[model samples]
Target: MKWSRAVHHVEELARRCDTPSPVPMLPVTGLWVFGDLLGEPRDLDWAHVAVIVDLPVDDVPWLDIPRGGQHWAQAVRLREPLSCLWRSAAGPVWNHRIVRPALVWDSTDGVRESTLSALRDGLGHSVRLDAPTPSALQTQLDAELAVSLRSLRRQHRSYDDQRWRPGKLTPHADSLWRATDGYLDLLDAVNAPQ
Candidate 1:
């Protein structure tokens, strides 16, 4: 998957925002979130996330995961409203909302593998992240998650470079490339259109 590029884009944007840094971005190599954090079986969709940011436990938000939506699979609620505009090779994108920090678990060994194995065995998987756990488990989870995000970023960069060639534009290609360029331009032109 072209996950590395997406991870890189998110990391770059996060850096530009000047917010408190969480754990470094890594690829979704082999990790999973286990415990009360995952409310239901359906929440597994978020299991494939390429980036997981580890936030202070105290600072983590206790917001409800929106019902049946894929848009903000990893979003958290915050007390104060905050927004940012980012441009990528794609086009202009806006993030308008408050965000909270939380512990991120890489699904590599935790949820990803166990869940799939359960499915294959004709058993269903269900667990919540909030349940109490030992510090050792938490440490392992965080470490794996960090590694995964980094790997994802590298993979994404490779995919983007391979799929999109620069300086060789047909009319159709020009329009598509323009969208990506426009996104970057908008980010650079924040508070002023270029």
Candidate 2:
């Protein structure tokens, strides 16, 4: 199904379900939607939809997700918030792939502006919901890697005397060390080659 139509279909379903229009999405920087565009009876053609969003920024890690990949489209529960980050860790991630569509995104905007019709219509410019190019994808990955490395470095540099007392490590220092190590591991995973 067309990206716009798929978006419309979801909006209508949300309305019929007595939910809000332009459903809330994960506040993080990625294009996300619920699993199966169609409601329960997955036999419907509209239920299987593929949407390619051209992001505003190329540095987002969300761009690493692959189509039909683990944690792509998630199943939204009645009381669940639209945001993906709010889900339980054991739940699915996202089903969409990270594409490098040539479209340039303003750092200020996010997937909501591109996916929600209300925001899309209100926007002064247009966005191309299309597949990504190899070059664009690589560039995005590079940017993401750089950001992760920088974050790791910043965390490393944040250490100070407060973190360590004269004879032993201070409580604050130990906490900082743990946090820095945890973040460093995460960044390392991101930097690892696919």
Candidate 3:
């Protein structure tokens, strides 16, 4: 499938799952695509796509995607029941090779660190998620994400920097940015006087 098609598929799947759409789907990056593709023992087609949603730390849900070949398209009960829902699709395959797709949301510090550690244990690498806070951290994360996005756009648009190795950009950049925006919206919703 074309990259665009794959992105659309993932986006639609995510929507169907009732997960809020925060950003346009982008290619999952960072790891050496080849190593990640080959390292997993399972059939690429059957590789499970995991989705992590961030709720208030105290209110976080505990759910597990069932083992065995269960596609996200199938209706499955969330282990940790939540009011919100979401769906996602597998990454694209190229020349019979599997690519992985991921979705993330802005979380609190406790949630972010715990989730990052879990992902790292499972995927064998450190993963960063944007944890947008209403406090000072939000400003810092927003600036960092913006810089990363700008650099990524440049690399995607030009090969001018054969030497300019782009830093690993997360799939959730846009979503995190949106979540930050949502935080601001929440402030307005609560009618906090400026």
Query: Each candidate's lDDT (Cα)?
Result: 0.28, 0.34, 0.30
In candidate 2, what are the lDDT values of residues 1-194, reduced to their tens digit? 44445445544323332322123332222223433331222222332222332323222223222222222334323222222211111212221232211112121342333334532242312333444454554554455456445544544554564455465555445445544553454456445675
Clashing pairs in 2: 26-83, 56-105, 71-93, 71-94, 71-95, 72-94, 72-95, 73-95
Q: Give a tens-digit lDDT track for model 1, residues 1-194.
A: 13233223323333322332222331121222222122332322222212232322111111111111123223322111122211111211111111111212233333333443332332323421233234443443343334334434444454456556764435334333434443343234333321
Best by lDDT: 2
For candidate 3, the per-residue lDDT at 53 reads 29
Clashes of each: 33, 8, 8
* Model 2 TM-score, all chains together: 0.32
What is the alpha-carbon lDDT for the whole of candidate 1?
Answer: 0.28
Tens-digit lDDT string for candidate 3 (48-89)? 234432222111111211122124223433222112222112
Candidate 1, which ten residues in sequence have the lowest lDDT sum? 91-100
Model 3 TM-score relative to the real fold: 0.21
Q: What is the lDDT of residue 104 in candidate 3?
A: 26
List the candidate 3 regions with Cα displacement exceeding 4 Å.
19-48, 52-72, 76-194
Model 1, position 139, has a per-residue lDDT of: 45
Winning model by TM-score? 2
Point out the higher-scoring one by TM-score: 2 or 3.
Answer: 2
- TM-scores of all predicted structures: 0.20, 0.32, 0.21
